[model samples]
Structures are given as C-alpha cells and as structure tokens.
Target: MFPFINRSGTITPRLALIRRMAEFTGLYSWHWTPAEAEAFTSHLRSGPKPIMVSTTRGYEIPIQMFCAYISDSRYGWLEEREQRFGTVPQQVFHEWNTVLHVAEYEGDPRSRPLHYDEVQRLFDAADGRAEQIRARRMKGSVSAIRGAALVKTLYAYAYGLRRQESRGLDLVDLRRTPTNRSWN
Candidate 1:
C-alpha cells in the first residue's frame, strides 16, 4: 500500500537547475553490435576529415551528387564499412585527399554536371605542395557506382530528376558536350 499525500517533493529552482545540468552532461548509453561498436571506437581514434567539394559561392549540394562523381574504389569503402562495421565507417574523414570535379553551372542536386574547367582548376590547385595537399587520411563510405551508372546518377541529380531505380547512361552519352545533353 502507498502512503497518503507524501509531500517530499521540492520546487527549488537551484535543485531543478542542477538536475537539468546533470541530464545535459550525462553520457547517454546506446546499444551497438560488436562491429558497430568497433567502428565507433575506430572513429574516436580517427585522423582527418573528408575533403568535400565545397563552393565559396555560398551554396550547398546534396552529398549524393559527390557520391556519384567519385570512383568505384571509393564507393567500395562505403560498402565494406556497411558490411563489416554495420555502419558507414569514418571513411568520409579519411578521404580528405579526394577532390570532386564539380561543374561550372550549379542548380538542383538532380542535374548538375561535373564541370570540365572546374576539374582542371582543382587539379591545378592541388599541385602536390606540402600545404596544398590534404594533411591526413580519414575514412568513410560511398556506394560503388562506377562508369555508366555513375554518369546517369549524377546527370539525374544535376537535372533535378528523381527516379526510383538507377538509369545508367552510355559512356559516349556523358562525353557529349553540354549543348547535346538533355534531361527528363
């Protein structure tokens, strides 16, 4: 049986404040599989952040665009992490050295192209100087979409198209000039 009207509760702001602070600083526990836990710890023992293709133009693009532009080897990093680590590992931070050859024209995430001149510019800037090159190698994940699949995904993203399934483009199609390209 419970006691009747037990008035043990206090309304002091100081006690409330201390309780709030404790909650704020407390280490909230999360359950993870062995692989996930290992990967999380691996993250703590990390190195560098991924070098994403950011623009000084004061704009942001969906990470999917960058995913489409990079190589299959990079994507494999993501796949393995997903399989072994049970989460996308800290590989993004590891890929600090990579540079995405972004296109000159910018638009929605679905249809922008990796620009020709911009790619050249990025390479020129990264001329292997001690300061110019990325300092540390980090880790992260990317879907291993290469060749035609990559081009199609990027094209759709650049043009603002949303397809349920992947639509691979021919290598020759991607090689065509900007004028010849069409989006649906």
Candidate 2:
C-alpha cells in the first residue's frame, strides 16, 4: 500500500535503508567541507526547526533528519578532509548527523532562500572548475544570476524532498509555490 504512494517508484524498505544510510554516514561523508558543514548547520540553528519533523497518517513510525545543507566552510569531499587531517572531527560529524536527522523526520522547507553573500560562498565552495564554468556561462547578466538562483533553489529543494521521502515523509507534492512568497 505504501509502495504505490512513492512518487519515485522506490520500495519502502529501500527507502528506509537509504534514509538510514544518510543518517549513519552524513556525519562522516564530508559531502561538504567541515567549514561548510558548520556554516550550514549554523544557518539552520539561526533559522527554522533545525529539524523538520513530518509523518504519514496512521503510521506508527516517524522518519528523522531529512537534509544536511552545508555552508561555505571547508568545501571538499570527505576523503580530502580526512587525508589532510588524518581524521574527521567528531563534533562536526555529530552535529551534522543530528541536523540531518531533523531534516529527515521533518518536512524540509522547500526553498531556503540564500542571500547574495551565502550564494557567493556556495559558489566558492562548489567545485572550482564547475563554478568557473558556471560563472563563465553567466557572463554577468541578470539572466545568469536568475538561472543560478533557480538551479541552487531547485537543488536544495530536491535534496530536502529526497531526504524527507527517505525518512518516510513520502512527499507527493513537487508543485512550486507562488514566486511572491519567500522560501526562508
């Protein structure tokens, strides 16, 4: 019954495993550099739930830690950080896992609107070559900025949805809210 509810056609057990894996490994993945992770976590603390909790009606279980948004701190793969430091910081990993669990259990707010500075930091933190290419593509136009903005927003929203669904939120609505509304 729950299987049919999956918009992505994934099985419930598989979804459960994915959510669990993200929960267990998110702290260790270095998916974002440590600095970025710290910043992202800080942003959450400064803003909304820090953890978004969502549930399916009639279900006895609830999912947790839906998303792990990284800030612009140490921006690189986990391995790089590990290789450089010989180990990942436990405190960082702990906080990351905690926030991720919250994002997973709670429905992530669709758009975490970023200010210009944050966007710039994200650009710097992302792959250097990719950022360069993206910047070049922008060629300094309002359209370029708009395009980048759309991509970032979409990426964040998709990540949140995936994390939520993995945790059993099983979100079905991908519909965009009115543009006039703020996503913060």
Candidate 3:
C-alpha cells in the first residue's frame, strides 16, 4: 500500500527472506500455506543456536509485508500474476504463525537508549565546552569547536556516519553547492 515498500532499499532484504521461505517450503509462492510458515518458525526456534523470538519475527515481517504488498488490489500484481503464472501469490503468514507486538526494549537493560532530555543535555555540554575554550582563547579552541560540530553532525546522521569517519574529514573534502552557494 505504501510507495516506500516498493523501493529497492526495502525490496532487496525482503527478497532474501522470500527466497529463504521458498527454500524451506520447497514449494512455489502460490502453493504456499500457513502450515509451511509455522514449520519454518519451528525450525528457527529449534535450531542449535535457536534464534531469539525477535530475530525470527524480523524474518517473518519482511516476508509478510512483501506478500501483503504484492496481494494489494491497487498494485495490480494479483491480476498480472494470475494471468501469467495461472495462480495468485498466497500470503502464508498469519497472526497465529507470527509474533504479536506486546512491549519494546525487551533486550539488555544496560544497552537502552538515552532519553531525549539526556541527549539534549549531552549536546548542550559539548557546545558549552567549545564556547568555554573559545572564551579563554585556548590553543585547542578550534579543535573544541570542531568536536562540538562533530557531535551535532553525528547525532543528525547517526545511522550512516561514524565518529572516526567524521574525525578523518578534511576541509578539502567539502565543496560548495551550486544552488545554495555555501560550502558543505
């Protein structure tokens, strides 16, 4: 139902899950049944290093979501597939075979994220330290400012950027944008 789900970024991982499910069932998509999915889940749970419930759900979500996307009426895949393959894609996943959302942060307590206020306080402390260094005309004032900027930038793009990668950046690596006419 959503455009983002159709994008390559999302589809690639979902494709992997789809392949695994197909491999497990030894059946094509149209012939799939919820029983096979349940068997797959059981296999995951009984493995030597039995997967965590959450990890099993991670595999289930992608396959379920991708199936739902293809089965949607607006997507026209049902008609196209039925005509070409002589069968429609079946959604093997069901509530009975998949995990239900109950509560979050079920993992290690010590690894929990900081609250919003704590994050804000951390940023404020970084900026204040930079200002303190600049006020006293300290030798490392520039470095302090750069450190604060790195903190903010890391927080802004935390998923993609790393602290060491940011530290390695040079002024020469930045260039002016054509439209904005500002160094980036």
Candidate 4:
C-alpha cells in the first residue's frame, strides 16, 4: 500500500504516521469519515510534541496528503477500496477543520520589525562602535568600519531593499553621485 504513494520510496516516515492515525482512530483502514479524521488530528495535537510546537505541519500536512492520495481518482485508491469494502474514502481535512495558509510571514514576533527608536539606537550603537575602533587604532579597525558601514547601509535602505538584495550587494553595486552620495 505504501509503495503506491511515490516513485522514490521516501514515504516510509509518512506511512508510519498514517499507520499511527489508523491505530489511534481504531479504524485500521483508509476509509475514515471526517469525525474520525478530526479525532485523529485532535489526538495528534494533544501529543507531547504538539504541546511544544503549536504548528500543525508535522501532523496535519502528512495526514491531509494521505487523505488526498486515497481520495484521488488518478491513484485508483477510491475504486480499489470501493471494490474491497464497498466504500470510497472521502477527503477528511477540509477547509472547516484544517488550518488555512493565509500569511506569507510565519516568523517569530520578535522578528516582526524594529521600532523607530530601536532602529535609531541600533545605528547609534554601530556608529559608536566604529568610532571607538577608529579612536583606539585597532588592528581590525578597517574591517570593523566596513561592517559598521554595511550595517548602516542596510538599515538606511532596509525599506527599499530586500534582505537578499542587501546580502548580495558588492562595492561595485554602490554608485557615487557628483555630490559624493552613495546610491544602490
């Protein structure tokens, strides 16, 4: 049954979860209703790992994929199950019970955005560090200055440039106008 899933044979781990779901629901079959599916999901959610990690990617996605594969006509699972058990497997993880993929940013709250004062403080600290390095005539003052300048440039143009754009920037990418102003 597992061999029919994918060409690569890398679905063993996922198949383990499906087996666990069958055992949890006590159905021992793929032809489970939405109630059983909900129960299975709820059981997984109440597990130890689920308590630590709030996201349902570990439990929900694999179950949903398995249900999709069983319900799909192209896979012939529905026809085969109907012939064997006189029943067809229905999609259990519907919109009502499943989490929706709405937001692009699923990062931590601390990573959201720096406040205006926080940004000012960051720039001040970077500039102060650079100045202190210069005043002390440090051996790696040049590198320190370069890093500070890079930080300032990134912060200044953070609104205009994407993270990759700033990271992939080279010295040649910066153009100096007649007024000695640098533009990326």
Query: Listing every candidate in turn, what is its Cα RMSD in Å to the true structure after a full C-alpha superposition?
Result: 25.2, 20.7, 7.0, 7.3
Judged by lDDT, which candidate is best? 3
lDDT of 4 at 112: 64
Q: Sort all candidates by lDDT, best to worst.
A: 3, 4, 2, 1
Cα lDDT tens digits, model 1, 35-98, are 4323433443354842223431211121212323332455466566567655542212123333
Model 3 spans with C-alpha error above 4 angstroms = 1-16, 27-31, 45-58, 65-90, 103-114, 128-138, 156-184
Kindly list the per-residue Cα lDDT of model 2 for residues 1-184, writing each as its tens digit: 5554774544565456435444644644334244544454344345554433332211112222222222223555445556885654322334334333434334445665555687667755544545565767755455555545544544565532354453452234334467524343
Instruction: Report the poorest 10 consecutive residues by lDDT, candidate 3.
Output: 175-184
Worst window of 10 by summed lDDT in candidate 2: 57-66
TM-scores of all candidate predictions against the true structure = 0.16, 0.18, 0.50, 0.56
Per-model C-alpha lDDT, please? 0.37, 0.44, 0.75, 0.72
Question: Ten consecutive residues with minimal summed lDDT in candidate 1?
Answer: 56-65
User: How far off is residue 21 in model 1, in Å?
Assistant: 60
Q: Write the per-residue lDDT of candidate 3 for residues 1-184, one digit (tens) a residue.
A: 6865766677777787788888988987776778888898888779587876678788888778877776788977788888988888778788777877665764446765666787789789998998998899888989988888777666654433565777786655344456544333
lDDT measured at residue 20 in model 4 versus the true structure, 0 to 100: 85
Candidate 2: lDDT of 165? Answer: 52
| Best-fitting candidate, scored by TM-score | 4
Pairwise TM-score winner, candidates 1 and 4:
4
Residue 48 error for model 4, in Å?
3.6
Q: What does the lDDT come to for candidate 2?
A: 0.44
